[model samples]
Target: MLIVGEIHTALLPHSRPLTPEEARGALALAVGETVVQWARPVPHTASPTLLHGVDCRLPLGPKPGNRHADDAAGGSSVRAVGTVCSRAVLTGGHLLQGSAWTAVAPPQQPRRMPWSYYLARPGTLETIGNFEARRLAEGYLLADGQGKGLARKVRHDGGTALLDAAAIARHSVHDVLSRPVLDQRPPIKTGSTRLRWAAIADPGEGRAVAFRLVGNDRRRMSLVTGLVEPEQIAAAAEDLAVHDWLLSAVAARIALAKIGEDPRHTLRTLRPVVDHLLHLWSAGARTSRDLEFMWDSLERRPGLTRQWTTMTERVRSQIDYGAADLAAKMLDMMEERQKQTGGAGEPHYR
Candidate 1:
């Protein structure tokens, strides 16, 4: 079984963090579906899972305008139909994420099936013809030059338009960000990040996760899970996406600070880093116990939390140094004026 999904993460477009009530009201996506809220280590809220239908071609190659050896491995033509599950997640009442995913399994019959058949099985994309799951995963992760769907396949290759699950996921995020519930006045301006993940069920009781970064705003994750459930695989993917987004966002802020240029300016630039981002580094806090090994393995090799701790310390050191430098300059100006006038007097500083 192959489970593919994408997550879009960004700061909630509001001046201040939302209260639990406000968060709940904003996340009401499905009719009569109550939103879930958690107020433990930090304020969190999630919308009920909603399903959207998709009927389109599954892309062939990893990228558009090119072909790989595996591009010709699948059937001559392939079409898929199913529902993609999506929802909005709010962490610490400030960070917002929109996630969408679908499971790709082998074709049940030689020909296509009815819409109701696919709809009955939520989050399962039914392929009409034979297709290689591994090839599909690669095509989705690489996507296109724009990280959208394969625009050329429908016309050039004589196939239907690519299904583009990532685009569907991104659209879900835009819908949430544009809602009237948000004031649209974010405290700080940071770009959004996207993570595309594919999890393959293995034949054992052990799991492994691999993460890779492409350029800056895009990420790809491949998971080998012992579990067969699509929901559990989706949960692990979402958890990884959140942590990766936080790290990327904070690192960008650090670069924007431009330390040593102007102490006060750097401090002003990083104020949001301290208030909104520093406290949200709780990894594996929301994941199930069965999936803890994935995080643990990451913590051992790449050391995600270690990087965060180092970055937090760096932010604090800059704050301390800036304050000390400002104080020293003030004291020097004041003392020199006193020496000249033989009495304490108001000092002017550049």
Candidate 2:
């Protein structure tokens, strides 16, 4: 059995005020710490993985063209759901199950010695919210123990209602956001441009669609956005150039590592190098010069490549260490800033 839990931090002030940036940062830190703490005891069960953080806000009511059919059928007006700051799944072993001592006892007991202090920080509230959202999003209605039917309740009912793992697997996030609805469908032609160029065969809708094209060349990288309506044509034509580029880079790295007389057999050797590239790309370091620098540094010296691996590992470790460090630093910063402004102890703005 998989045991899942969530933690949420309230944006609204309870005792002290926080800026939006500070609140967001605090929320992120709290979620990170909670996961680390949960994973500590279950070393064998938890697999190492990267975490993706999502901050989303769903606005109330329909956009200009798309209105919910349910509303026309006498449903209540849709309202904006509150902002959600959450982390995705942190999959691990069944350590939380089977033994009350390992599962309940540790969490119940004060690992840090003072439970009240843990509850006192507004950051704690943010942590809880993220955990709850993760639970609801991943655990909904699959009957798989990981999903607890929570997805059913939290699911949106309009254009976004049908969005689930299947849809996500089929479409990109950008596509999902830009999908057109029958109610608020744009005109077939807007000015000289045609909106619904062709009909989608699979979904059988003649609706227009937006496609994000990501590609890279020797000189530079590019992300071209296009609009198309035909379902199959759109899916196929949409450039996954960026993903392809990244994958090619990985393949190239693997090939290079295999070139020498003493070939590296294990993925562990290549994992760090690939991870470094991934980090750079994610950090918006897309220029050819940056990529060339990374490639050259890795290939320049064997020791440097090893050092790159070690550095990646160190940074990963710092995620846990840095959370604690950040929390403390933030507290100090907030306190000093508050003092300078002569508004110490005031609750943060909502």
Best by the TM-score measure: 1
Off by over 4 Å in 2: 1-162, 165-227, 230-233, 236-249, 252-350
Which numbered prediction scores highest in lDDT against the true structure?
A: 1
lDDT of model 1 at residue 138? Answer: 70
Alpha-carbon RMSD to native, per candidate: 4.1, 26.0
For residue 51, model 1's alpha carbon misses the true position, in angstroms, by 0.9
How well does candidate 1 match the true structure in TM-score terms?
Answer: 0.87
- TM-scores for all candidates: the values are 0.87, 0.17
- For all candidates in order, the CA lDDT equals 0.78, 0.25
lDDT of 1 at 340: 91
